[model samples]
Target: MGDSHTSHTGVRFELLGPLRALRDGVEIPLGPPKQRAVLAVLLLQEGRPMSYDGLVEAVWGGSPPVHVRNLVQKYVSGLRRALGDGPLLEWTGSGYRLSGAAVDDLRERRQLVDAALAARDAGELRRAAELVARAEELWRGEFAEGLAAPCLAAERLRWSEKRLSVLEARLAGQIEAGRPFESVHELVRLAAAHPLRERPVELLMLALCRAGRGTEALLAYEELRRRLAEALGTDPGPALRSLHARILRQDPALLAEPVPVG
Candidate 1:
């Protein structure tokens, strides 16, 4: 079913970090890990019904408690009590739905990402970088960190990759907006953190070349090439190889201002 709340829910939720519910800026005690997992699924559902079977699958995976329905009812009661006023979590005859929740960090991050894309499309590169940076600040830690459900683990992995993608976009925007020097150190850290990941290395190479450190850029490419060959018995892909060649030829195009990063 659709949402019940016609207006703001007053309860601000966070699933990007640990699952948290805040009412009037005060944190509510959401009980145990399993209990928090229930909230995680509900928040992700966004006012849609979470059927008992769906809840069992999401919260307990393949080995749910024998008393699943009764356990769910108890969990819901605790959640309702913690939420107190305004926000409502109710059984909808068919399933459970939460209403009156507002401004979840997950949605907040999406909003910022959307704004950044709009700014980028408008050619407001600096504004795009700033908006993406704000979105990056939304994560206190990994999304729904350590809750045991397989579905949530999949969500965590997806969010992790998305965070990396956004970081790449933000760094790329900085380079294209005439701020390559500022992107180098962070790109360096990003490359080191995910050695097998190629985009950060690609951006790192571009940033170094743009900052007039062409020699270092070539070395960065060589390092990635060596790492890839040794680990996967393969070479850097075509785009990265082409970039390496461009840097080597001192492709004056590389020095040209506002070259979009690969």
Candidate 2:
């Protein structure tokens, strides 16, 4: 392989939303949707060869061609040309597979966010924030943007939920560190975007209380209670209810309490 091709062979592939390739600090194009789908399946099976039938099932469901193997090979050839050779893609007796060196963003994000949570649990708030920030930055809108497939759609929701969880944790950490004022604007934005999520509602209440706006905090909780009943036929969770009681009691402890890291 040419030096450039050899160096680029182990390009990281991201297929959680849209297909993206990162090699040498730049994103190499993975072509149109079908071509991207082909790469998605290959990346999904990274480090392990997949049979022709497996690729066909992943890409075409039950409508694959009799010449599925040959067609798959053609797609692989295009990817190899675009990706440059080294161990990017290979055909084997088992079928076809992308090399393990291909970076999987979903796996990486999970690890980074989990590590950050662990650090937070240990009271290493600064390092936890950095790790969570880095992980959240990995997301580029919906996974596989412009790519259409039932499989990708289903997978997108799973990744989106994980990303949201990470965001919630990171934002909670910021609030705990006395940065709720910085995140107040963000919490407002989140409330606007996700009116149903109770965590943001609680966080906003706490932020208001911390800023000495106890009256406003009580009003916010009342609004959330109304919204939850109207939209979800439910009440606030235990934490939010307890916080509301604290607000009502004018508990000095509420003001002195450390924001619990989530």
Candidate 3:
């Protein structure tokens, strides 16, 4: 759950940003693009043996070359060499399995997020914020940025959504702990980045109102309303509209620390 690197003696695989491998502190040079893609497929299904047909489908999609099985074998050979003598990869007669204990940043991030949610449920606001903050730090960039395999698209989207959810939770926790001013800047940026996602915009408005900047909060809502009308042809949802109305009347409830939700 907590952030951790792979152990010194075990194989460490990184698939969150790019495909990387290390063993005992020495970097293993994964071969060319297709080879690395093969490694990704294997690592994504670590202990399970992926069939040759599955590997072919993952690496080449619908346009496999003639003698594609031979090509896949060659890639596997290169990966084995890159893996050195770690016995991490094994052939299971029908397919290959990547064995041994492996550390993955994506898995670790998921764990941290789970821990953060548990902390929040227990009313440990500060601990939840810290845990989600740690989880957010694991994302270096887009998932497997340079990997050109079609098979990674679904996983990439899934992980990206999880990351955004963690960000939203972290920001909400910060605002709920009587530190709306501390999160105002971040909420502003998040709202700008995702204009259609009303949660961040709502949070930004609440933080601004709580910070005694009611005018700016109103302006933020107006800008978002304009954008939404232009882009989606819809008014702000009920939650956001309610928040806007509350801010307009300087509702006393806004002065107290309230968890902003949309």
**Per-residue alpha-carbon lDDT of candidate 1 for residues 25-47, written as tens digits (9 for 90 to 100):** 77789987888888888877878
Candidate 2, superposed: residue stretches over 4 Å from native: 1-10, 15-17, 60-73, 104-111
Q: Best-fitting candidate, measured by lDDT?
A: 1
TM-score-best of 1 and 3: 1
Error of 2 at 260 (Å): 3.5
Q: 64-171 in candidate 3: lDDT tens per residue?
A: 989898888898888888787764677789888877635478678778888988988899989989998888777768777688777876678887776777788788
Comparing 1 and 2 by lDDT, which wins? 1
Model 3 stretches with alpha carbons more than 4 Å out: 1-4, 7-9, 101-103, 260-262
TM-score of the candidate numbered 1?
Answer: 0.92
Q: How far is each candidate from the true structure, as Cα RMSD in Å?
A: 3.8, 4.1, 2.5
Q: List the residue pairs that clash in candidate 2.
A: 17-143, 17-144, 18-143, 18-144, 18-145
lDDT of 2 by residue, 2-58 (tens): 112212456666754568776765787777677778787677664798887777777
Candidates 2 and 3 compared: the better one by lDDT is 3
User: Candidate 2: lDDT of 142?
Assistant: 85
